[model samples]
Each structure stands twice: as C-alpha cells, then as structure tokens.
Target chain A: MTRFRRPSAPSRLPLPPLAAQAAGFALTRLLRRIARRKPAILSRLGPHGGARFLIDLRDSPLLLLMEPGARRITAHPRRAVPRHDAAIRGRLPAFLAMLHGVEDGDALFFSGELEIAGDTSAVLALRNALDDAELDLTEELAAIPGRPFDGWLRRASGFAARQSGLALSRQEAMR
Target chain B: MMELVCPAGTPAALRAAVDAGAHAVYCGFADETNARNFPGLNFSRPELAEGIAYAAARGVRVLVAINTFPRAGDQAIWHRAVADAHAAGAHAVILADLGLIAHAAEAHPGLRLHLSVQAAAANPDAINLYAEAFGIRRVVLPRVLTVDEIAATNREIEVETEVFVFGGLCVMAEGRCSLSSWATGLSPNMNGVCSPASHVAYAEVGGHNEARLGGLLIHRTPKGAPVPYPTLCKGCFTAPATPSGPAQTGHLFEDPVSLDATELIPKLQKAGVTALKIEGRQRSRAYVAQVVRAFRAAVEAADAGAPMPAGLLAKLTEGQAATTGAYAKTWR
Candidate 1:
C-alpha cells in the first residue's frame, strides 16, 4: 500500500553527557507535556505503564529509557544502556516516522527498518497506546502555555524535515 | 460484481476503509468474543455502533465478527455479542460456533448470518448444511481451496461465497489448529490469539537476532535481516532423526509470507466468489485505507473484464514476499 522507500540516512547524536542529558530532558518534557494534555495515552498502557523501555537509536551514540507510569525518561551512553523490560532499536527517522504516524509500525518492522526485543506485549501495548493517541509532537509543543514561538517552531520543523527527510509531525492519510 | 470487503481494527480504521471504497467492512468487539483480540485494538460497544453508523451513511455494510468458539461454561458472552451486534444495526454477523449460530438464528431470525472462515467450510456440503441449518446467506471460504475447487464448490452451493485475497497466510486449517495453545496455552479459536505477543520474546545472541515464542526458539536471523513474528506455524524447527530420514532443520511447516492474490481477482470472480476479503484487522488505519483503495481499484477492473493490476503492496506484506497459496496449488 504505502512504501517508504527512502533509506534513513544515518545521523549520530553526540555522546557527551551534556548532550545526552539535554536530549533526555527534552524528550522527558515532551512525554510529560503530552501525558498532561492527553491522559488517555498513559491510561491505554494499562498494566504496562510501569515497564521500562530502552529506546536505542542504532546509529546514534545515546539511548533513552522511558517509564510511562512515572512520566519520566532518562538518557545514557550507548555503551551504558540500562536494564529494561523491553528495547526498541531503529534509525532516528524510523522512530520519528512511527511516532508521527507518517509510517506504519508493522510495515517498519516487517521491512527490517526497526527491531524490538523482550516483553513484546509491553511493546505492543505501547504501540497501540500511541496509535490511539494519534500524537503529533509539533501540535503538542505548539500548545505550550507561554510559548509565543509556535509559528517559529512549526516553520523550523518543516525546514528540518525537508532538509533531513525525517517525519517531524503527523502526516495525514498518505495513501 | 465482486464486493470488496475490508478489515478495520479501530473506529478510525473503519471510517478509513469505508472512505477507501469498501463495499463492506468487518470488525470485532474489544473483548475475547472475536478474533484479533489484541490489547488496545478492536471496538468498544459504543465505538462499534458509531462505526456502523459512519459506514452506513456512506452506503457501506458493517459485519460484526463473533467468530471465536464459545467457552464451555460461558456462552452468554458470545450470545450477548450477537444480540448487541444486531441491536447496533449491523448488516450481518459472521459466526463460527454452531450453537452460537443456532442461537442467533432462533433469537434474531431477521439477522443475516455468514459462516466465518474459522468454521473451515470449504465444501459445498458444509456450506449447504450451514445454509439449511442456520440460514447462512454467505460462507467465507477457507484458504485451503484451490480456484478450481472453489468453482466446483460454488456449483452446488446456493449461497454467496467470500474468499481472502490478501494478508497473513495460515498454514493449518483455520479454527482447527492447536499449535498456538501447545506453545502459549492460548489459541485463535478460543483466545483469538496465536503466538500471543505476551508469550513472545526476542534477544540479541552473538550477532544474531533470535525470536522465541513460549521460551522456544522460533528463528534466528543475521542482524538487520527482517525477523518475522514468532508465529508457531511459521516457526523454524528441527525434526528429529527417524529410521527413514535424517534430522532436518528449517522452516518445516511453512515459510513466513503473506498472501497477495490481487492478480487472481478475475479468476476468483469467475469462480463465483461474491466478495474479495482483505485480512489484517490488527493493522492501522493507514494500512486499511491503502489496501482497501488498491483492492477496490483491482476489483473494479476485474468486474469490467480488464487485466488485474500488478502487486503494489509488496512492501506492506510480511517478509516482503507474496504467494498465491492453495489457490494455484503451486507447491502441491
């Protein structure tokens, strides 16, 4: 049906503690922001809200750990990725594409663009939760209370997506 | 003309399928009453009613699937689902269990009934029996029938017939397989799951990606290679040595592949199929829309006596490989 034939060009993140911490802080804020706005996202996780997930960008130097129950996320060096109940590994764009609904998760996995291991049910629950949410991070960010930079951020997202070919927000009905 | 039936796992998917030109859309409730009972999938009672209304507004029929076998001690759950489906204005109810079918027939005689594929009714006799016994108006033919056999079966049956044209291919007889329960203690016919994701796990072992179901190794692939879900029937296995043959290690039952019979639309139409059904109720709205749109175009072309279109869904299938399966009897 829909074919994402473009290969995800490798983009490695800086492994320095400051960079990793900043990335983790940003993602953690994003998750909390969405959770506050759309409580159904976490509610959909059911019992898996507490499961630890390791998000490993294979080409990147840092990994992310997320706990929906605590509404928290942390970052670590790739070599020091912490213990987790489950892990999802993929290119950065692939992860974003799935998150933004620009690409189908099963299609991504079936095409070998992504890899998952351990406690598949948790991963499936998380996927379904995200699917139900129909999340668009750009929209969430633009909704921030004191953020007069919505227009600027939206413009920047468009520019970055065009330059790097990453899906930064939801793509509606590509088929 | 062959009706294009599509699957919808969620309300959004149901709307997408209808908008994409499905003649009918099939779905199930959120509980174990139907198959595809994955977490966060299927519809709630309110959602089903809304979805049915949405499709009905667009001239699309909604068929509720309550195909799982009823538990020995708890048949009310299944019975209530049929009643609710009829009450919610479903166009029909696809059922498998004989008792449940009978119950629906007697309790709601006006409700249209279609024999589910889970019933494994691939012959004219079985079809006619269901038709006579429970007033089945249609039979979703099992995937085991060849195109020729289908034509032959249609010659004797007096009801409409539906056939799966795409999606995950099951090697065992539908509804009759016990392989998943042996591995996971849950099955499709009962629990509406196979290799239930809860029992599956994957690990990185010595530069290979190993997938397991119920703690049993299903497959190991080199890193970056596509790894299939560890479905029991499609798992790689090793047969023990016997007097007549040495031990064998490989995909002994069936290869991991999805069915794509878009090219055979004309043949199936000629075989007297009333509908061309696309599988994957667990897939997303995007998938449902894409496949429904593609199949709708193909069905339209076939009905007009035009050449069937090429397979544009190769990238969307499992293992990126498509097969004709029993339709062509290529392997047999």
Candidate 2:
C-alpha cells in the first residue's frame, strides 16, 4: 500500500555535460566515503566484487556505472554507457525509493517498473550487499568527517529531494 | 486466531516485522543451514542472538530455520546450527532433515521442534509420525495440500499446523525437487539455494530479455517487459515436437506467479491452521514490513469475523499476478 507512485508526467531531469561530470564526481566521492566507513558493503559482494553495474534511468539520458571492487561510480550519457556486467533501468524516483528503503526493490521489479539485464547474479549480489549495509545516502553524505560543508550537503540534499519529490534518506517513520 | 509467522533475513527486518505486528519471525544463520542461503543474506551468531533479544523484548518469537538437509559427512555443521539456535533462546527450531531432527530431539530435548515444509509431511500419518517421534510442536504443511485436505489432515493429527499464505510458489514437492541441481549442480536441500543467483544470467538477445539458469534458457520477455527471475520450475521453454503433437512452448511446469492466499485466511483458519507464514527471507526490510502489515490487517479482520481486505497486497506479488495454488484445487 505504501508503493511509490510512478510520476504522471514524463518529466526527465536535465543534466548538461558539465553538470553530469560534476554529479558523477560527487557520486563517486560519496561512494568512496561510504566504502571507507562501511567496508562490509563491498566485502559482502564476495566474488561479484569486480562486477560493474549500470544504473540506466529510463526517463533520463544519463547513466551511472558502478564498480564496487574499485569503489567508484561514473556517470555517462545513455548513448555512451560503457560495457558492464549488469544493468538496471528505472525512473529516478523508483531508484531513490529503493535506495532509501521507502519501497521494495523486488516489488518494483515485479511490477514491471524496473528492468534488469546482463549478469543477474552480479546485480543480485550488489543488491544484497546494499541491503545488508542499509546505506542512507543522505546521512552518509552529510557525515563528511571534519568538514563544515556537511550541513550544507544535508540542506542541499533535502532541498533537492523536496523539489523533485524523491526520497533521498531513510524514512524512519515508515520503518 | 492464527499466528502470523513472518520472515526476517536480517536483524533490521526482524524489528520491522515485529513492529508491523508479526506474531513470530523466522530466520536462519548466514550459511547452508536454511533454504534461502543467498549471498549477503542471513545472520551471524551474535546477530541472531541480538535479533532474538529484540524480538523477545517485543513479545514476538524468533524461530531459527535449520531447514536444509544435512550432507553425508558434514552433519556436524548442521548440528552446530541447531545447538547454537537453542543457545540463542530461539522459540523453536524449524527442521527438515529427519536425521537432523532426530539429532536435535536427542541432543536438546528441551528445544521445541517444528517440522519444516521441506519435510513434505502432507499426510496425517507422516505428521503424526514426526510429532510422536521427535516431539515436533508444529508442522509447516507443504504447498501441495487443499483446504479440505488440510482440514482432514488436521483432524487426524495432534500437533499444530502452519501453512504458507504468501510469497514464492514452489510447484515441485518440497524438499524433493532436483531441477536446480540438474541445471546448476547445486541443490537446495544440500547447498540451500535453488536456481541460485550466482548461476543465473540475463541477456538482451534480439530485442528480448532472455533469462537463463545454469546456461539453460528459462524465460524470455520482449524488451521493456516485466522479466521474471529465472527460477527453473517457472521457466518458459520449447518442448520438442513429437509424432503425436506439435512442439509446446510456454511455462512448461508452472507460471512465474507468486502465492497470495490472503483471501483464504478465513478458510485456512477454519482448516485448523495454527499459523500463517509469509515466505520471503531473501527480501528487504521494507518488503518484510509491507507484507507483515497487510497480513496482520487481514488476519485481524478474519479474527474479528469481518471480510478479508480486498487486494491488500496486490502490487507486491511476483509478476504482478497471484495464485491460490493447490489450496483451491484450481485444477480440479
């Protein structure tokens, strides 16, 4: 009953080349920070550590390539999406909902809102690792080790989430 | 009123299930001790102990599932799981292997036992045998029984009976299927996974999403369509043409649909079922909470003598379709 609603309009977030590069850099930095704090997220991947995953946003032209073994993520245009072990295609809200534990990933996949291809096991391993780690992106990004910009990051994430109607942090009340 | 027995793959899921109104939650150690032995899933011993405490504090019981059959030479591994489960103050240990059950009964006489569905004790004789011999307090009936059959079996048995009301559907007889092993060389009964993700692959072939299990084509969906996880029993295949007929193509064994018996909660309660189990230990905590909440509402409505909630969890089913599976005797 608490399923995330599919956006009524076919609106896509616009990311120019420079914006995409900056977003990718921010994402990669955040992932590396998370990996350093929670090693189990990568360690639990076991043999699938080397698998590269593609986060294909169906409504957007941007794609995210995640290499857990290297603890890095890079953004690419849809046409330039590099070779990867697996790919998951969904809308931004769906991905954010799953990442924030606001919705079930399996339910989203089962409902036909998400599409996965290539190596299923690698994708599954990544999913399990993330689930086990229970990462809250907003919280992780905000804890910037001795940096005063932590507050600004939290504020920006909250503002972005509010403006876009996306869930970027764990909803404790829902849980 | 029937107890709501939910699944929790992690401590967080355990808390979610409890908060969502589960009467009990079942889990297993992060090894081959249970059927859902997937990577990055299940609990360590300390985590299990902590989860038990968390559930116990909330008045929700935690049942340890050591349901996988023991290997010939590695009985000790399964034995340690049972012992550790009891030591962690588990309400009961859900067991499948007869030898392992017997071992638990002998070694820890104080520990309560429940016959896992993997035992395939669909008949009253088998149920009674397990109850009398091993002092099993409950029996998780397999998915092969109809409501009338379950009622009849309950009439002939003395122990409590539990049934799966939701989640993945296993068309094969529980604990006896070898399709996964035939394809992957790894068995659910021995290694604790069926159609394991490690051996599964998905490919974009000719604008179709082709799902393969152990290198064998199982299902294919047109691009952008909902793709099912390539579980062997529910896979699509082409049966070679024979002299008698043309080749058959489709879900040869069973369709990739999940079991959603929520509407039958009243009937199952009338059938003398002691508990209703939701089967998704490999799922996320959000999923666990969502399902637990819905089932709790349905069970409450049933207990209050009210109509069951309509489509309480329609969106969460696999393939967005649900089946009563054998419980209604649909074939008949």
Q: What's the residue-level lDDT of B90 in candidate 1? A: 97
lDDT of 1 by residue, B178-270 (tens): 999999899999998978899998888999988898999998888878888889778888899999999988887778889999988899998
Error of 2 at B219 (Å): 1.3
Best by TM-score: 1
- What DockQ score does model 1 reach against the true complex? 0.59
Instruction: For model 1, state the Cα shift of residue B203 in Å.
Output: 1.3
lDDT string, candidate 2, B103-208, tens digits: 9999999999999999999898999999998899999999999999999999999999999999999878899999999999988888899999878887789988
Q: Each model's DockQ?
A: 0.59, 0.58
User: Candidate 1, B87: how far from true, in Å?
Assistant: 2.4
Residue-pair clashes per candidate? 0, 0
A1-175: candidate 2 lDDT, tens digit per residue: 3445556533255555596688788989999898898887776677889989998877666788999888888888765769988899888888878777777788878766677877776777677677766678878877865478888888888888888778888866323
lDDT of every predicted structure (CA atoms): 0.86, 0.86
Where does candidate 1 clash, by residue pair? Answer: none
TM-score for chain A as predicted in candidate 2 = 0.83
